[model samples]
Target: MVWPPSLRQLEFGDGFTVRIATLKGPPSLQQLWIGHWCDEHIARVGWPMSLQQVFFSGNFDQPIAGVAWPTSLRVLSFGEKFNQPIAEVMWPASLQQLSFGGSFNWPITGVVWPVSLEELSFGDGFNQPIAGVVWPASLRQLSFGNRFNSPIARVMWPVYLQELSFGDAFNQSIAEVVWPASLRQLSLGRWYDQPISGSIFGVVWPASLRQLSFWCRFDQAVAEVVWPASLRHLSFGVCFNQPITTVAWPASLQQLSFGDRFHQPIAE
Candidate 1:
């Protein structure tokens, strides 16, 4: 079947098998989606060379050890049912953003990550240890999945990381973590209610931090905590009913949001 020469995006909802040496995908295709029960060996050869974004969704749990990832691919997403081991997979060098779906929960200590990756996120099933993992230098935004509660106190976070988010299960101590100087955004998980001021040496606040979020169950007191000088946005989730009257609001704060349960009055 002949496809339109100008076709730039394509999606195959049914099972698709890329025949060896006879792939007939769109020449200028920039986006491709392979959905539901796709043949795991679809990578027998290679995808369209011009592909910039690719998505694989539903039941693709096969090993991708020697798959030839598109060299020009910039963004790749794996959907909910994917849960494959990727320790031996070669990631595309051109990839900048990647996201894993709900079922992915592999230990990535031995995985070779792409050097140019800027954004990476995991889904709900991830809960692996990551203390000694060396993150990519080019990573700017990173987030853990819902089940990730790994101790990251000793993890060497990327020096240039600007944004970091944790999953709902994260409740680790941060007494020894030295926040990266380049960090701009941070999000604490739903169950994170760590006492920052109670730590022997209070958690070091990154001077460049701009945005901070506390998820559903956070109700920690911030009265004695030192606020960052550059913080502009701060938010508390649904369960925050803490008294903020004695808390020192950052001078640089531009927006502040409180949860529905917050009954504390702010002094002008």
Candidate 2:
């Protein structure tokens, strides 16, 4: 039920928990309270006051549109209905995991990820990926668009990136990617690219990389592709038009799956 007053602070037991029954205008308290109510449920929540995770979702009109601010918050996600100018919002410095899955008309231009940010996800709507967004030093997992040709070649990934997943747009040339030595798990595949280049740079495969999947359509032969020695789990799809002749299996590779025809197999 909607709160009768626009500014009413519902105090819960101690801190770490709160339920705004009906906030009329703004919180009269100085600690943590709503300051303004401009066509917004709570344009911004989680001031320096007390609150761990804040979730704001409504059809209010504001710059933030729908956002929550928790100084110590580790995860921050914008609702799919959020279409306002989110670029104006300053992400919390304590954020570790962030997901932008909203189908908004705006693109996340030049926003630096906080040093605390570790995992980041971008929905399909993020058009024209940023050429260079510094990944957080602590970042490990990154999942973004996978269909068509999403420009990931230029984005400056964190040196510590480990688990990376592409949605469907996997048409990137391996040559364009500068894999970090700290990388562990790399997953790339899908109906995304019609013709992928097999000659893409062959990563020596970091010793950290344990789980890896190479699936997708390639105009060339699979034999041209080189598998990293550290890869443990590998999955290959009908990405290669021609058959693969030699399949170099890494000693660490324990699980392998070859879907459909891959030209020639490990030379029998």
Candidate 3:
């Protein structure tokens, strides 16, 4: 089918294999989401110069070499099955956000990140130690997936980081982790089953933190967990059956959300 030249977004869903080589013209496509059958022919097509976001979830087991990607691309995402190490891929310099899926288990310790990157996300299979990785200085947000069990306490977090997230399997205590002072939002893994104990209280939270969120399976006594005075928003996910009566809520807390399992009543 012939697409119009003014097309801005294109999504190739399941059961459809797009052969870009057969396409007639370069539509002004800004976003491209491809299915599993998309092959190397994508690089051979005359992509629109206005293209900015590309999401490829194909069966790319081998390295994606010599693909002439659009220089205007800003966001790139790979599906769970794309396991090729990205160390050899010539990433576009204009990229600001990058994400990997569960199939990506490659180590990127020595890989150089784009200087323009602002956000980075890892999939469930990514267990590499990011402590020694040279993160781009411009990075402000980072996230980890369920299978990522790396010890973040030893990693040197970026000074400019404002948001951080952990996966369910990240069971390490943050007692020794030096959080960045610029952090404002923190999200704990939904699958983290450990109780919130002294390991959490031992760490000194950054004064800039304003939002703190806990995920499912985080059942612990709130009395033992020290609430940071700088916090303004607090949230708990389902399966968190902890009581709040014995806990000391910080005066700065402006909002509070409880899960269905928490049956304790709040005092006025």
Candidate 4:
């Protein structure tokens, strides 16, 4: 097919195979989504230098150690069926945002993430332990999959991380985890019912924290929790019926929500 020189984006339907040596796409193509189930050798489809975003949303599960990823690629993603190991694949230097699909449960401890990465998110099936994984210094936002309940006490969080979110099954003790000083937003999982008493963790949260959210089943008391002075938003989960009369609400708080179960009297 003769692709138009002015064509900028292209997404192939499923069941396509790369029998040609090169895709011969237009020079103006900046984004490409390949959805072929049988194409194992992705490097055979020569990527244009102008391509900035690439997505693999098919059954391409072959090891990609020898694939020559494009230099200008800034965003890359895979679909829910992609479960290949990427520990040996050299990632693009300029890649910023990367997301794994639902079925990617491969071990990623040895994978060297891009140095310029800003946002990285794992899919629901990724529950790999990451104690040895060194996240990039430039990462600002990071999130785990729904089944990820790995211990993060020994993991070194990035210094500039701004937003961090855990999945629904993560109910591990966070008393020993030292959150990043630059963290501005934090969200705990739905099943996180652990005690975050100030006596146990002690002024642990960074002063830069602006938003905090507890999950649906979190019914812990906040009277002993140390609310950050810079906190602007706080949310307690649905099952919380804890008394707030003695709780010290932060002076900087602008938005406060005691989930559906907060019907206790203010003077209680």
Q: Who wins the TM-score comparison?
A: 4
Count backbone clashes in candidate 1. 0
Q: Compared with the true structure, what per-residue lDDT tens digits does model 3 show for residues 46-123?
A: 767788998877564446555666788899898877777766567778889999888888878777777888999988
CA RMSD for every model? 2.2, 7.0, 3.3, 1.9
Tens-place lDDT digits, model 2, residues 41-100:
454443533333443332223465344564666655554455566555677787787776
How are the candidates ranked when ordered by lDDT, highest leading? 1, 4, 3, 2
lDDT of 4 by residue, 131-238 (tens): 788899999999988899888878889899999999899888787888889999999999888777766654378889999999898887778888889999998889
- Estimate, for each residue in 59-122, the C-alpha lDDT of model 1 and write its tens digit: 6666678789889989999888888888888999999999999999888899889999999999
Q: Over 4 Å off in model 3, which ranges?
A: 1-4, 18-27, 41-47, 193-201, 221-225, 237-246, 260-268
lDDT assessment of candidate 3: 0.78
Q: Can you tell me which runs of candidate 4 are displaced by over 4 Å?
A: 15-22, 36-39, 201-203
- How far residue 242's Cα lies from its native spot in candidate 4, in Å, is 1.3
What's the TM-score of each model vs. the native? 0.92, 0.71, 0.82, 0.93
Q: Rate the local accuracy (lDDT) of all candidates.
A: 0.85, 0.57, 0.78, 0.85
Superposed model 2: Cα runs more than 4 Å off = 1-41, 44-48, 56-62, 65-68, 146-148, 192-207, 216-220, 238-242, 261-268
